[model samples]
Target chain A: MKKLSRNQTFMLITIPVLVLFFVFNTLPLIKGFMYSFTNFKGFGSYDMVGIRNYTDLFTDARVGKSYLFTFKFAVLATIVTNVIGLLLALGLNGKIRAKSALRGIYFVPRILGGLVVGYIFGYIFTYILPALGLGSSMLSSTKTAWIAIVIVAAWQAIAQTTLIYISGLQTVPADVYEAGAIDGATGWIQFKELTFPLIIPFFSINLVLSMKDFLMVFDQIMALTKGGPAQSTESISYLIYQNGITGGQFGFQSANAVIFFIVIVAISVFQLNFTSKKEEQL
Target chain B: MNKKNKVAATTNWPVTILLILGCLTVIFPLYMALVIALKKPSEMTNDIAGALSLPKSWSLENFSEAMRVTDFWHSLGYSIMITVVTVVLAILIHSLAGYAIGRCMAKSKFYKFSYLYIVSGMFVPFAILMMPLVKQTAQMGIDNWFGVILCYLVFYMPMNIMLYTGYLKNIPIALEEAATIDGATTWSTYWKVIFPIMKPMHATVAVLTALGTWNDVMTPLVIMSGTGANTLPLAQLTFQTQFGTNYNLAFASYLLALIPILIFYLVCQKQIINGVVNGAVK
Candidate 1:
């Protein structure tokens, strides 16, 4: 058999994958953009509405509330998970017995499905916590419902972030700590001066990943609260999913989704730029 | 080295204490789930302290009942099938494409541009595509298991491709050149030479894809809803309402869903952690 040319080989390899990608990935994106400008209700013929959905998004209360809740949840969850994860990573990285076993235990939550974790915690918040006199169901109130979501989200999310931080921590050479110890710097001071600066890249990665992931929080909200009590914990992804796909607000939700897409991109890019600059300074 | 030895010899009591506490927090929920799932509903007193106690009988009744109510085996079958197929296909197809693009992009602008085009999908959130995708899949008569698998493949493509391509960079072209000099065709060279060499990356992609597919709720919920078919996560959500007051059954079902991934994690904890860190850092 004759050997194929480089371009021929490349085309042979990529054509099928690219076609499938375009059909499943790119087409929906393009269609979503087009539908955002229309009055399509996910079925039947519809006329283009010419920015009506986008305009309505500006004045929409539920949309605004969902965005607020999502951002608030993302920020809180990011901080909570990163702090806890970093601390846990620090502990795990220390000289310890059965270190791998401990690391495996901490990572359990990362492997479980989000919906399952949410449901387990849903029962906890509703029954166990209240029974423990923590308070009446955290999922029952608008004010505190988001807190439950954050706790559950962080519980699962911290697993990976902690692992990432541990990886980051391992990259710090023991000699640096030795140098600090010789200078009489103790634990906290050594960490602050020697360890922290070296791990900024990992910290930034965790921050950006956690932020992006939590921004699109959906499964946990569904299993825990279903965007209740009174849509208080409804994330942007949940809103788009529940309202757009199931509620026949296809075009409207597509508009929201497009904006959501832009916001995520902007935030990711901004965070990357911000963190990269900080990394350089260090 | 003396300082390091002294630090290591002390056992780091504070860090050890922190790790133990963190371990407690991590293990607490799983223990609660297990305890709750093993008990009868009648044994679950309204008081939290009572619920925290070990089950009096330690029966698998709730597990059996949960299996009946949730159609647990059916959903488990679907989850396994979907995850297996998606992981297998993702590894094979993405590796091939990655090999082509990773190898040829330097010499071919088209391949480089294609690489960018494909990877740019990474930035587009699934939210933007959810509604249109539902319509597209429905119109294509594939809004079922096949469609769900296809979505997973495409959804995971950008990241998998990126990872594979990056991994391929470390593999010397001399191997492929040697194969060619031995009169191996492109296909033969890829399969005989490149494929085996990419095992580590294949494992990374498989593990990541399997975890994502098995744990995903949103995609299956969007595509497979109303079709009477359910992945494990979707099945859990579907029965959430029915499991309303039956906390034991709910916990039992949650435990049932958790078992497979839990086992997978146990077997591959180190690789999973390294794969996640590799994916994140790259």
Candidate 2:
């Protein structure tokens, strides 16, 4: 009955997990990087043309459009979801009647599969809205279709984001608000001075999270628009799906995906540094 | 004192009104889905503003039709199986690794290395893994439910590990020490003492992971692309596409796909909301 050392016990538990991650995540990532430089058709090997796929990706107008659209969607989704989520959290965290029920109602969509929500909204845009004499269907236009996509993403995303904000709001000491009131600070002043600063951490979490999620937005786009209106609404992730899965340009999309990965990692690092610095000053 | 009361009363009404209006907008699309899902097919043939109004005759026929068209029960079963297996297995493994890092290896280099490794997965968008992962899975002869589940485990490991590690860090070491003094083995102590304390975090992780695995489309889309394997989301997407003109059946299938999750959410809304908050604000 020899007792294992602390590090031995830890390694015993974590080794299998580490192996699974290595095989399933990191190894494939390295392979994906390697494949980007080759002409591999997903399976059978081909010549390694160094950086040709990267050069091709840089010149591809459609891929560039998809990147632009994904960025636009992610930025807008982050802002809208955070603002609305914060507002909901503020209102519902107070002494509202049936607060629990309202929160439940608001969160219903969050639990739903994005495909379902997209299909429901797709029906609304293509059929119901037109039937209501709302002029032309929004999906027929590039601009309005993107707005619809953002709206659906926000509707579902706000549920979890609001809950995060509520948690953040709960952390603010009651006495802080009470003290603000004594000094005649109330309404917007109280929120701007006290609430906003405290919830900034939650704001960053929701921002980066929703931003990342929105950048990879796939299910809803697949169900709703399928990147319609002449492929104007295609997101980067969806484009990768299209190119890699359907188009069978695995090597080329691999190049696009590697670039996407680098951009995301850079953004996340920059965001964390920027927000943590602000959090400190606050 | 009089002025303060007046201000409070006036401000409360506007905020309340604003919240109500916002909630209505949020709920409008869901309400529309319900309306369409309930309407009789015959009654839907020539309706305009009827899309906005309540159904004249409600029936369960559309649901039955949807079920028939999409093999709804089979897909539902598949979705449940995948979600349950992925979430339960992923949680078990992630918590083990998280606990090892949190408790036994806190000061070890392995802890820092594993933590950084797991967190790095969060920033690497799934796009990067799509092409090569597919090839890797094919080479490994794992393009089935097992492969999809494994993919989910790898993809979700980072966040799940983060949640469990953060949770385990807070659990007092005194409890484990007492168990050791009572002659409990390490595994026994974890199962009896530490595991019980982790129930709240377990609930949080379970709800979050369950919802994510159930709603995901991309993983299954790639893994099961040519396999004809359909989860509920995939079923809905394909059904909608095949029957693009059939709004009644499409909406009904959408409802069928969402109903299970919607019910689960209603049952566990409180836990899920708290879970999201706890998972984030750490």
Best by lDDT: 1
Measured by TM-score, how close is model 2 to the native structure? 0.95
Model 1 TM-score (2 dp)? 0.97
Compute the interface RMSD for each candidate structure.
Answer: 1.6, 2.3
Q: How big is the positional error of residue A257 in model 1, measured in Å on the Cα after superposition?
A: 0.5
Q: Please, what is the whole-model Cα lDDT of each candidate in the order they appear?
A: 0.90, 0.83
lDDT tens digits, residues A129-231, model 1?
Answer: 8887787999999999999999999999999999999989999998887778889776799888899999999999999989999998988998889999998
Which 10-residue window in model 1 chain B sums to the lowest lDDT?
A: B1-10
On the 0 to 100 scale, the lDDT of residue A42 in model 2 is 62
Which stretches in model 2 have alpha-carbon errors above 4 Å? A1-7, A43-45, B1-11, B45-47
> Please, what are the lDDT tens digits per residue for candidate 1 over residues B1-282?
576667676667767766777788889889999999999989987787667899998799999999999999999999999999999999899999999899888988888988999998988999998998888889999999999999999999999999999998999889999988888788889999999999988888988898899999999988988689888889998998899888889899999999988888878887888777788887
lDDT (Cα, tens digit) per residue for candidate 2, span A88-170: 99997875666677777777777888888887788778877888789888989987998889988998999889888888899
